[model samples]
Target: MTAIDIRDVSLEYGEGSGARLILSDISLTVRSGEFLSVIGPSGCGKTTLLRLIAGLVTPTRGAILCGDRKVDRPSRDRAIVFQDYGRALLPWRKIWSNVALPLEGGNIQGAALRERAIELLKVMRLEAVADHYPDQLSGGMQQRVQIARSLAQEPKIWLMDEPFGALDAITRQQLQDEVARLAAERNMTVVFITHDLEEAIYLGDRVVVLGAHPGRVVEEISVDLPKPRDQLTTREDPRFLAHRHHLFGLLQGH
Candidate 1:
């Protein structure tokens, strides 16, 4: 089953003489329940491609389909977890309410909304901080809350834009493991964008490498590693290192 299908997609910014093409004829398919991570040089249109699938941006050409439906604008089936956790969370609302915000004005309310929010918070190990405001939580804790909120929506597809980029090494690794576990448990189809090669390989079923200066797919590598992966064991595997080297060479234009 295809969760996301991008066919001959291209995105251009500016216009006329000032026009700059960011993505050139990019095409990819994300399978249902698959975790895909996109890696590229700094200026590449990795985020642009992600936004296109998220219905946050329109492609200059080609079509983006999500679960057989064309994506022209944002839909409830998709949720984005951005790198800026503080920006994603509401400073005024308590953690529980923030997690439940997506359910407001629908059917869920009062005790039921609170119950779901608290349940998700517990999944994130944030039950103790349910009443805390965004300002009260640390960076890692804040990001966790954002993740819980995103999960609370129970989105079928998750588009993560370097969600753990802002964290320290330990926190990043910790969350990386947690994310992988949670994604598998929820059977989510994820499209993750990251500059970290190891993180990409560790989290993704397949890693797509994009080259900048007119961004395009340079290489696509299948991890083939067993699931329930851990950072130490997976990273230490010889095959993992080889794939990392291949990506490094691709990024170097070799």
Candidate 2:
């Protein structure tokens, strides 16, 4: 089943005088329970494409369909996790409250909401800092909380824009593994945007490459590496290295 379908979508920033075309005739489909990563040059409209899917921005042309329905506005069915965790979270609200904010006044409340929030926190291994403020936690911890909050929505589709972009190498690797595990376990469809080739290959079932200067799909590579993957196994796999090198060549326009 197609969870997301973007058909000939194009987006422009402004009209006539200051018009800047971002994406041109972009089309893609994400299958249910598939992990797809988009890798592109800086200004390749990768984030713009994600925004279109999330309904945060509408395309000047073409249409987006989520399942059988067309997406006209933001829905709880899709959740976004951005690179900036601080901006995503509320400073005044504690961790649990931040996670529970989306459920406010919408059926779930009191003990049930609290229980769900704590359960999500536990999944991210953040239960110890449940009552802490955003500022009190490290950068990695804040991002984990943001992940928990995004998951709390029980979204079938996750749109992540470099969710671990700011973390140190070790922390980033840890979270990448966690995200892969969680996405697979939940049977969620994910559209992840990142510039890291290895990370893309590690988490994605297929990697889509976009070219800059009027961004378009340059290539789409299938990752045939086996599942239940660890960083060591992925790194050691000959097929993984072959895909990585192929993607690198594509990125370099080789």
Candidate 3:
């Protein structure tokens, strides 16, 4: 079953002669519980593509459908985690409260909110810092909080834009494994955006590579590698390296 169906979508800015086309004729479908990594050179409108699916932006032509409904506006069903974890989290709010923000309304009440927030924080290994503020935590911890907060939203689809881009190599690798594990465990539909070829290959069930200048899908590859990916073993696998090399070539205009 398809969780998201993007059909011939195109997005343009302005009118008449000044119009700038950001995305062009992008048609892709993300299967339910599939982890899709989108990779391309900078300015390929990767973020714009995410925003369109989030319904934060609309296309100039064609349509985007999340299940049976058209993506016309923002909904809690699609939770987006941006690259800037610092701005994505609230400074004044305690870590637990920040995660609870999504559940503050919409029937969740009182102790239920705290219970849910703590539960998700525990999943992210962030239960230790549940009482600390966002500013008090390290960059990686803060990003974990942002992810936990998104989980609190109970979104049908998770949209992440270069979420681990800023973290140190070790932390990023840890988070990468964590996200892959959680998404598989939860059977979540995720569209992850990244610049790193290996990161895209490591975490994705399939990768969609885009070309720049009115960003469009240039190639899509099935990962085919075994699941429960190991940071060391998976990257060292022959199949993983091939996928990485191909993706690198595509991004490098080979």
Candidate 4:
């Protein structure tokens, strides 16, 4: 089943001569329970495309559909994890409170909400810091908290924008595995945006490469690597290397 459909979409800022065109006539489909990683150069509208799917921004033309519904605004079904974890979290709210914020509006309350928050924190390996504030945690831990909060929503589609960009190498790799595992276990549909080609290939079932200048799809490469991928073995596989070389070439205009 198709989880997302971007049909002949185009986005621009301003109007007439002063208008800046960002995305030009881009179209794509994302399948349910699929891991899709989008990569491109600095100004290739990767984040914008993600925002479009989230219904945080509307296209100048064309429409985006999430499942059978037309996407016009953000919904609980779609959750976004931004690269800047600092801004995403509420400084005054303790870890558990932050995670439970979304559930507060629903039927969940009191002990149940707290329990659910702690549960997601455990999934992110952050249960130990359930009482801590965002200011008390390290960059990586803060990101993990952010992830836990997003997961608490139990979103159908996960939209992540360079979420691991600020973490140390070790932490980045660890979270990459955690995200891949969680997504698979829940059968969640994920739209991951990152500038790192290797990271994209590692996590994605298919990698979508966008071209700059107009920010459109250049190529969509399928990653046939086995699930529950091994960092060492998967990266070393001949097919992995082939896909990497191809993406690098596309980005470099080779």
Residue 83 displacement in candidate 2 (angstroms) = 0.9
lDDT of 1 by residue, 1-254 (tens): 98999999999999999999999999899999999999998999898888899899999999999977899999888999988998989899999999999988878878999999999999989999999899999999999999998998889998999999989999999999999999999999999999998899989999999999799998898999998997788999998999899888887879
Off by over 4 Å in 1: none
C-alpha-based local distance difference test score of model 4:
0.95
Candidate models: Cα lDDT each: 0.92, 0.92, 0.94, 0.95
Candidate 3 lowest-lDDT run of ten? 105-114
Candidate whose TM-score is highest:
4
lDDT per residue as tens, model 3, 134-174 = 99999999999999999988888999999999999999999
- Please, what are the lDDT tens digits per residue for candidate 2 over residues 19-62? 98899999899999999999999999999899899999999999
Question: Candidate 2, 60: how far from true, in Å?
Answer: 0.7
Q: After superposition, which runs of candidate 3 have C-alpha atoms over 4 Å from their true positions?
A: none
Query: Which candidate gets the maximum lDDT versus the true structure?
Result: 4
RMSD of candidate 3 to the truth, in angstroms, is 0.9
- Model 4 lDDT tens row, 1-254: 99999999999999999898899999999999999999999999999999999999999999999989999999999999999999999999999999999899899887999999999898888899999999999999999999888988899999999999999999999999999998999889999999999999999999999999889999999999999999899999999999999999999987
C-alpha RMSD of each candidate structure in angstroms: 0.9, 1.0, 0.9, 0.7
Weakest ten-residue segment in model 2 by summed lDDT? 100-109
Clash counts for all predictions: 0, 0, 0, 0
Candidate 2: which stretches are off by over 4 Å? none
**Candidate 3 lDDT:** 0.94
At residue 200, what lDDT does model 1 achieve?
94
